[model samples]
Target chain A: MGDRAKSLRNTIVLIAGLLVFWQLMYAVIGEVAMRSPWQTMRYTVTLVETDFFWVHLTNTLQAFAVALVLSVVLGLLIGFALGLHRLSAEAMEPMLVALYSIPKITLYPIILLAFGLGMSAKIAFGAIHGIIPVALFTLNAVRSTKPILVKTGRVLKLSPPAMVRSILFPAAVPEIFTGLRVGFSLTLIGTVLGEMFAAQHGLGYLLMNAIGLYNVDVIMSVTFLLVVFAAGVNGILLAVDRRLHFRV
Target chain B: MRRVRLYQVGVIAGLLLLLEALCLAGVIDKITMPPPHRIAVDLVKLLLAGKLYPEIGKSLANVLLAFGLAYSTGIVTGTVLHGYRTARETLDPLFATYYAIPVFAFYPLFIVIFGLGDGPQVLIGFLLGVVAVIVTMLNGLDRVPRVLRKTASICRMGPFETAVHVTLPFCAPYLLTAAKLALAYAFIGVIGSEFIMARSGMGYEIGYAYTNFDNATMYPLIVLILLLSIVMNGVLTHWEKLLLARRGQR
Candidate 1:
């Protein structure tokens, strides 16, 4: 309880510090390039109230939701399949790490070419961004399950599916949750990145549109919203993540 | 090990072959993606032609600059922060949630502040990488053996000398891991910024090629970037493994 309260205080202080830094930056740069924190907040409220913003928000949310689902499902399947086989896991782990390190943004053009500028492309891009981390984490989690647990399952004459359901899945839940948290963020980033490049709808597109028009208010509001949404969700997830880790 | 290698090679070759077959069968159109062999040939031709040498050079230099800046500053800051427990604690939340926030969203703001120049791109790369380096460095510092600190004190070493001659050397493997991560983030930041809105660079050129329907140029560049990142990551991974192996033996 004390630790939670302290963490809450730390978060509030961090947010305050960031606001101060933003205001300081705004003062130095002036209205020509950016807006003050007060002005940004006002603009964000107004922007959120608008139907135009909602359309883009819905589109982004829809894509992000689908992408996240796909990433989690595909990631878990890949992870579990490979993790069940020691040799396959050994061969592929390095490759996944390599893939993870790659810029991936450069591959946007290829994605555009393949999926051809629409919702599908955005989801695909986001899923690619997310799937690897989830898979990598899950792989390690399953692989590292206590050997004694597996032995117990085997001694009971449990089938492979039964062994996984009863033991591996339960053992790997915490690590897998961490992976999902990470995947959630990366998927959001990837979706926004996709929208930024080729799409005509979404907050990322709106930001790009604002850039072209040099509308500082729109830029600040959208960016502010993205930061808030991402950080807020991640904070909640991180809290849950900590509690889970602690329980274990 | 050899069987594993074969499996890896076979998987890669199989995928390439599959893609080639798809292209040849017209299941995948020419405009979307050419055959694997065609892309390889074009990449070789593009390199020999030296058309994008300047852009490639500019992008790599910026990545290196970002990596160096982030790595050095992160080490110093992490070292300093390690001494102040309260400060590190206060800043822990920020570090944890940093990557969750899209650093790219700040690119536009950086562009506004600094203009659409190398400054914004390099800054993005640095911002993306610096936190990771710091976190990794702090983790490394946490594991520094107590006896090592005792040895430094027995030698009557100053803080600076202890860091240089003792703590820093002990953290070498962590430094390399941090470097690898920093480099990758640097590449993502610089290239992604360039892709979004930049005057020139491989990313910008690729975007330019795409808009112009120049698949010939675009595919080769994309392949090059992928290959560059993979090779760099592979080399570092190998080096990291060797370091760990040596440490294990010792």
Candidate 2:
């Protein structure tokens, strides 16, 4: 078989194996809580038919989109500013890493307290999650741009602004994109966490409701939709990355 | 670098003082944004009253247990996946997009499985930590020289011997990086889960304070968490530098 064909075959086999194991567990356990793959699949389809699912999903996405855009714009500006000077970058690097290590999730209450339990709180929570990674990585990428590239700009008689706009920016795009990808994931998580932590609306609220009522099927369905949404966005980004990384 | 380091410290200190003044002067809401001085006082009181240490210890214990589980599972599965090209191909897509999925989204399922206790918290922590470890370890494994495998075979080395002498040495740096990443993830996971649902932990304390509008207590706990993670990251950074320096010497 061709490499592509073999890969497809392997994936199918692995998926089949999982389904069998899932079904076997359900059969053996004979428990309502332990849903089989087929049941979860059916629940997943049924979930889309409901109006609340769309509402919650859209709210979550809206928060995520706003946070991501704001984070990128702010992060890029801050990163460029901080990264311009090696001395400054070096000085703040440790602090940034330390901050990144701290779990922003725990601060959800404070975020909500400051912004209130509305869309603002969710966006702020998510933007906080996305911003640090983007800023830190962009700082590193810009500051660490190869000296050879700067020399090229110098040889071209480019001014500082022109150099940054042309040479430095292009060189830094790949890494910034990398940070954005990480940011996107974190922001989504943050947004969901905000909802889940305590919100009047969003998929997270729906999830909490399900948990409270011991609605296993709804919980599984929501989780499935979450995965699908995440995978779709991530896949699109990866495609963009593959195309962009080489050209610039 | 040295001069800028001092500048950085001074800048951060100045910012904090400004924030402290802002809160104290009522420019910022005192109730919502407790001044640093008051938070510091709360911290001292908490320390003196001996209430903070046990919670710290509990959180640390959970983190450690989860980290151990994740590190082991990540290593074993990473190794297995690396050894099997077809299986790696089959599962790599899911692994690639794994982080995008909100881990807490599955908290309900976990609570159901483990029944609302440390079991669920630790399990979630492991789930978060293990993904990073597995990805990093796989990257390390990818960099293992083809020549090493050939040499190991020529020397009649068993799979175990080759792994220990050749693979482990080659993977050390990446493993270290992954371990640090995994440690951070594990800490985040456990603490985050506590915020979601837990009987005790630093996150719980913060959640508890926030619900009751106890800003004084909440602010101090938040600061404590910040300090703890910073100290931990600092240690990891120091070790990474030391290892890199030692390697550079060769």
Candidate 3:
């Protein structure tokens, strides 16, 4: 406990030092090109109180939530199908990986053409980007389940469905969680990219507006909020992963 | 082996033929989804006009420069941080924050600071690629076996020699994984930045086509970019396999 505390203290100190260094660099760069650290903070606080800020925040968050839910559903279904049947897995894996390897942004134009520039396009884009990781990871996890475990379950005369539920699903849960984490991150990236390319409103639009007006402080403030939101999302996922990653 | 390869080629060809048939049958509109032949013709025209090569060259240069900067800095910084656990812990939150903060959000700031040029594009790409590389390398360092470290020390190897001969070799797979991921991210970073604000590049061409509603041109550009990514990934994976084979021999 003492050692842990000491380590934590050292970490805090180092973080503080880095922040100071960042601020000093900003000071040296001056305010014409980039705002000072204090200026960015003040601007961030001011923006936080605005009604438009909340609306945009809600818009981005809603898109992200819908994307996340859809990805989890689709990923699990497809992953299960691929994992359960070896012949299907062998036939489909290459094509799936090929599609996955394609830079998703390349699909943006096609998606926009099909879905039009609206929430649907954003949601679909996010879902496509998010689903690949989950499907790939889950497929890998299920395929890698120990042969010994399957044999033991069969010897015990467990039913097929029971063996899967009792052995396979639990065995793959850790890897599934890893996929979930990656899927969530990709979802956020896709949503942000979608909004940036063409959107009427959201954080991406707001940032673009600030850029148009040359409002450096607002841009910096929005960037700070985005960073904080992303870190928070990652932290929550990490905590969930830790809690649910129990071995069979 | 021959049969399997032939089957794979047949499948790909069949898919292409099916797509072409759909376009010809008007099940898919040619305007929105052009046939492969049309795209091929357009690609040849663009190449002959000398427009495609320059644009591709510009984009490739930007990606390579940005990737090089990010790779060097990420590896060096990652190595140093791994040596000092205290430093790694301190930077962990910062790295997480930066990673999460869609680097795209700061495109405007970069443009403002560096102006509307390759400067900001490369900077954004480097920023995006470097963060992922650092995290991956750090994780790789942590996973280095304790036995390897003990053996190196017992052999009286100096710190620099140990790192070069033992630590780096062990982390080869992890580094390759990082390189693969970083390449993708760097591509997105550069293209996305260019899409929003740029004068010339493949991304600029696509963005121009979009504004003009020239789906024909836009579709071909997108195809080119996708092909580039596929080729790059195949090359990198092959390189990694060769490295791993050599390491295994060692």
The candidate maximizing lDDT is 1
lDDT of each: 0.93, 0.84, 0.81
Candidate 3 deviant stretches above 4 angstroms: A1-18, A87-102, A156-163, A246-248, B1-18, B95-98, B143-157, B243-250
DockQ of each: 0.85, 0.64, 0.49
Q: Give the DockQ of candidate 1.
A: 0.85
Q: How far in Å is the alpha carbon of A125 misplaced in model 3?
A: 1.9
Model 2 over residues B1-250: C-alpha lDDT tens digits? Answer: 5697798789789989999999888888876788888889988888788866888789889999998999989999999899898778877766777888888888888887668888888888899989889999999899888999899999999999999999988788777777777778888888998998888988888899998998877888888887877777678777777777777931
Ranking by DockQ: 1, 2, 3
What tens digits encode model 1's per-residue C-alpha lDDT throughout B1-250?
9989988998899999999999999999999999999999999999999979999999999999999999999999999999999888889999999999999998988898899999999999999999999999999999999999999999999988999999998888899889999999999999999999999999999999999989899999999999998898888888888888888932
Give every collision pair in model 3: none
Output DockQ, candidate 3: 0.49
Tens-digit lDDT string for candidate 3 (B98-123): 65567777788878877899999999
Candidate 2 is scored at a TM of 0.92
Q: Which pairs of residues collide in candidate 2?
A: none
In candidate 2, which residue ranges exceed 4 Å CA deviation? Answer: A1-31, A246-248, B146-158
Q: Per-residue error at B122 for model 2, in Å?
A: 0.5
What lDDT score goes with residue A179 in model 1? 94
